[model samples]
Structure formats: structure tokens, C-alpha cells
Target: MASVDLATSYAALILADDGIEITADKILALTEAASVEVEPIWASLLAKALEGKDVKELLSNIGSGGGGAPAAAASAAGGAAAAAAEAPKEEEKKKEEEKEESDEDMGFGLFD
Candidate 1:
């Protein structure tokens, strides 16, 4: 299994390095030429995942955690899921804003 994964990954990298579009056919051809048996689905999934993505740039930026990898930080600060879940409820947001404005007008939050 590990050999199959390595063969497919190397094949994809080779295609990317040569500026050739990576496809399941190309990957399978490379693996077959190298005498490695790989599942077609693995190659297809890899191709789809890498579609429209710059492979070299992706490799270069592997250390940058700018995507959805900050789950722990988001959860620690506050529930990121909760904040996003609230965005769809406009009425709740409006009511909260109205309450805040009214409280401010009553001088309840001025000193605080």
C-alpha cells in the first residue's frame, strides 16, 4: 500500500514538475511503466484535488497554516462554528444590535 501511494505521489510530482497536466491516465501510465500497481480512484482523487492548483507553489507553502488548519486556535478563542452558525440568523443579529443601542442610550454601558 505504501509503495502504491509513493508511486502515485511521485508520478503526480513528476507530471507537475514537467508542467504537464496531471490526470488519472497519466498517473496510471507512469505507475504502470514503473511496475507499480495503483488504484484508479487514488489517482483520480489526487488529480481532482490538484486541479487548478499550483503544485510547486503548494509544495513551497506547505508550512503556512492559512487554510482550515486552525481548528484548535479557533475553538480556543471561541467556537468558530458558533460564530459562523449565527451569521445566517439575521433577525437575531438585528435584535442584538437593537438591544445594545437601547442600552447605550440609557447610559447603561457609557461608563463601562
Candidate 2:
């Protein structure tokens, strides 16, 4: 797909999820704010495509479809699944360390 098309679609998704009305104007505004350089036609097409659609339902259905390019890329990269599985353990350890540091109070005070 064209880069403009991709940008417009993602902008539409964000607007929908935020409960904002999806329009070419809104999509263009978002893309412009992000410095995406999208064509006007792409935003208009996405707006029409999303008309009368429930954003939350569409997002849920998209998640359910599963196994797209990201999974394929991870497999191609080798051992990505193992790394991903280890991520939560690393996060838990970091959180525990942070809790311990916060408990020390470091001689700081609310008014100091």
C-alpha cells in the first residue's frame, strides 16, 4: 500500500478509538500534525471506508484475525518469541527494584 494510504488509515483508527467523528478533515489534520505528508485523496477514501462502522468493533475484529506481518518478521528474525517471553520477567524485576528505591525515601520531603 502507498505510504499516504497507510498514514490515513492509522489516523482514522486513532480518531475512531478516541470517539471522534472520522472525516477527511480530521484525518488530514492528524496527518498534518504528525508531519506525515499524506495526500488529500487518501484521507477522503479512508473516511468513506469507515463511515457507519463501529470503531471499537472494527479494532476488535482486526485483533482477532491475528498472525500478520509482525509475526512473520519475528519468525524471520530468529528467537524473537523467546525474547518476548522474557520481557515480562525483566519488567517485574525492574518494578521490584523501583519499589525498593522508593521505600528508602532518600532523605527527601514533600516541602524540600
C-alpha lDDT values of all predictions: 0.87, 0.82
List TM-score per model, in order: 0.56, 0.51
Q: After superposition, how far is residue 81 of candidate 2 from its true place, in Å?
A: 36
Instruction: Please state the error at residue 15 of candidate 2 in Å.
Output: 0.4
lDDT of 2 by residue, 10-69 (tens): 888889889999999999999898889987887888888889999789767886575475
How do the residues 1-112 of candidate 1 rate in per-residue lDDT, one tens digit apiece? 8998899899999999999999999999999999998889998998898889989998999987665545555576687765764565777889889988999888779569
Model 1: colliding residue pairs = none
TM-score: model 1 vs. ground truth: 0.56
Give the least accurate 10-residue stretch of model 2, judged by summed lDDT. Answer: 64-73
Which runs in model 1 stand beyond 4 Å of their true positions?
A: 66-112
Best by TM-score: 1
Model 2 ranges with Cα > 4 A deviation: 63-112
Q: What is the C-alpha local distance difference test score of candidate 2?
A: 0.82
